[model samples]
Target chain A: MWRGFSMRVVSAFLIGLLFGLGLVVSQMINPAKVIGFLDIAGDWDPTLLVVMAAALATTFLGYRLVLKRGKPVLDASFRLPTNTVIDRPLLIGAGLFGVGWAMAGLCPGPAISAAAVGGPAPWIFVAAMACGMQGQRLIRP
Target chain B: MVEFTPLSGAVGGFVIGLAAVLFMAVNGRVAGISGILAGVLTPVRGDWAWRAAFMAGLFAAPLAFWLATSEKPQVVFDHPLWLVALGGVLVGFGARLGGGCTSGHGVCGMARLSRRSIAATATFMATAMISVFVLHHLAGF
Candidate 1:
């Protein structure tokens, strides 16, 4: 059990490392770049669209091929999202998230990754985000 | 377009896809940034360990990169402090209520052909574009 737990932790770290590196290499961590992608009426950047397409294409093939196997390599079963219905909360919540992302040009992943290399600004954003999350638990719970 | 890097974007995206695949294969987990961050904050038994490790690796990767290459991600904040904080709050709340964000719905979930993820991805992306339009084109914000 201990061995399995350690393996999971180590692999998780490596995977996270790879992800962060991808964000940096792709320059997704740059707010100017992301916002530029959003600035459609202005000088819009299509680079992000290509990045998303490349990721989607690769993962589309990857998931289909991998799921054909009996089960995931490490776990007993594949853990996948089962929710299918589009509801109000999903819509409203997504709208809010989109607006927020546009305002700051940092999603959760980029925020954390940015904080690793930055000053107090990212931390403040993260702290505010935490409070918002905690507020959700309180208000909705 | 202000600036573009097609090759690096595609290559980085490919790396991200591979990391997501490895994460799902070995850990049987979705590499959703919001979900993982929320999980760490909520802390259900036996679940927080991997989240913690993954987050640690997020920071560690940039640190390692800086050590090796003397470079880090470049981020700028043009918004007011209040707006930035509010943006963070909305992102946190919205991601929690919406169920996932770019990594989950946009990349991993859409790739899997999950209907709900497809819907969520569309909704969030649309809103993101709209928000950008309103902020930049309409209001010059």
Candidate 2:
């Protein structure tokens, strides 16, 4: 059990590191870049689509490779989401996320990763994300 | 005007996604931004180190990368502090209400072939599209 917990922690750290690196390399850390993409009148940037395509390809390939092994390298099997039905929470959350992203052009991943840049936006985003989480906890029934 | 490269963004996303899968497979945890952010919010005894370390890596990796590559990254944001702050708060709230974010749903959850993640990701993408449309097309803000 101890070993398992430690393994999770290590993996999480590594993942977070790569994520931050990706944000830097892709320049997704820049809200202007993202906002520029959303800015249709001012050249209509589509860099974000490239990021999504790249991410999807990587995830798909990784899933295929891992699933082929029939067993994960970790302590337990992969925990796929069991819920399939769509509902109001999903819709509202997505809408809100879009609105926030449209306004800020910084989603959670890039926002958190950009924290390394030590800018005003990332810090603000992290704080808000936390409050949102805590607020949910309070409202959870 | 900054040049946008589709290939670079895609490659970056792929690498990040691969890293996320490795983290999940080895650690048995979903790469959900909410859980990660939440973990740090109300940390328990002996549980703080890993989370702290993980966050540290986020900042350190980008710095290390810039040093190694001899490249400087730029940040662009035209909004005032108050707008950015509000955006952050909204993201946090949205993630909690939705139960996941891009990392968890798009990369980790989707890799596991999770329905919830798929639905959540779809909603996220669609909402982002709509938000961008409104921001640039109708409102022109």
Candidate 3:
């Protein structure tokens, strides 16, 4: 059991490392680049669009191939999202997230990755994000 | 003007997707950064090791690159500290309430052809674009 658990942990680490490297290589770590992509009325950068398309195509095919197996290598079953409700919270929350994203051009993934190499801004953003997350839990939980 | 980098974007995006596929195959979990970070914050017994390890890997990516190539990833923060903090808060609370962020909903969930994810992605994308337009064009930020 310990061996299996360790293997899962190692795999997760490597996967995260790869994802971070991808973010760096794709220049997603740059807030200006992300904002440039979002800026349709100005000097827009379509690089993010290409990145999204590539990621989507790969994931679309990759998930199908992976899920065809009976179960995961380290787990008994695939732990996928079960929720399908398109409700108010999802819409409102996502909209709020969008506003925040445009304001700073940093989402959760990039923010975390950027904190490693960026200045105090990323750290401050991360700390505030934690507070927000905890606040939500307190309010809802 | 923002530089176009379709080649690196596609390459990096494919790598990101590959990491996500590997993670799902072995760990049977979604590679959602916000959800993963939240789990680390309020860790439960027997479930925190992998999450911590994944985050450690993310942090290590920059260090590894710096050691190997002696090059740090570019990160720009044009917004003030207050806006950054506020954006972080909204993102954290919003992601939790909405149930997922870009990686979970935009990449993985959409790849699996989930309707809820699709709606959330569309909604966030639209709002983000609108917000950018308002901020950059209308408000002249």
Candidate 4:
């Protein structure tokens, strides 16, 4: 009863809420800001650097301490990724994502969060991202 | 070069990190946006509810912010619909193929000191930087 569906759902909701708020507060939803940072060849914003550094620092510190504990508060074990082999798929996939990210400055999280304000671009990006994911399902080996 | 708010950016990033930490601590999840949304696309048993809750929370964030601050979250997509759509496809597919994205590999994986995530993260940044350089400089996009 303690570690049930309700708790998981509620916690996820709250986490999503915080994530969305953080994205918004950080001005990360702004395409210009993202593109500016990515445009390393030209004038850069360096805003993402700060956000990324702070986020990385916090996550690294927290993970170090929390990982030393028993399993998750609710789950049986920590669900960490296992694959360590860096291969072509990983490089190409990340490259493709980066191209898309620079081209439109819309990644999964930002795209979803920006949909709250954007007229149609967010919707279009999300729909296409979802389709791309589906396409991967059909093509993955 | 346009908008640079380091204080807010750092604070927001820390909040995002906290969310990521809590997610792993309580739910034992990685908090990767691509994987999370991808799961919703191909719903597995015992996974949809929390995903739905998280997504709902994301959708609600902007509205909640507006209510609190009387300011809409700034959203700017300068790319045309077609380009944006294409970018989304690439990002979606690449995330699926790469096994992760910025949040998953860049933050979560790196926090755990996973070498693959490190390599993947480096590759994506290189490609993203190159992509932006080509689009802005060479291609005149």
Best-performing candidate as measured by lDDT: 3
Predicted complexes: DockQ each: 0.73, 0.58, 0.82, 0.81
Model 3, runs deviating above 4 Å: none
TM-score ranking of the models: 3, 4, 1, 2
lDDT of 3 by residue, A63-123 (tens): 9999999889999999998989999989988888888888888888888889999989989
lDDT of candidate 4 at residue A75, scale 0 to 100: 83
User: How far out, in Å, is residue B139 in model 1?
Assistant: 3.0
CAPRI rating of model 1: medium
Q: Sort the predicted structures by lDDT, highest score first.
A: 3, 4, 1, 2
Which stretches of candidate 2 lie above 4 Å from their native place? A1-4, A40-42, B44-49, B136-140
- TM-score of model number 3, chain B: 0.94
Model 4 Cα lDDT, one tens digit per residue, A53-136: 888899999998888888998788999888888889988898888898888787888888899887789889999999999999
Query: TM-scores for all candidates?
Result: 0.95, 0.87, 0.97, 0.96
Question: Model 4: which docking level applies?
Answer: high
**Candidate 4 lDDT over residue span B53-114, tens digit each:** 88777778887898999998888776678888998899899999998888888888888888
CA shift at A107, candidate 1, in angstroms? 0.5
For model 3 chain A, the run of ten residues with the poorest summed lDDT: A21-30
| Superposed Cα deviation of residue A121, candidate 1 (Å) | 1.9
Question: What's the CA error at residue A27 for candidate 4, in Å?
Answer: 1.2
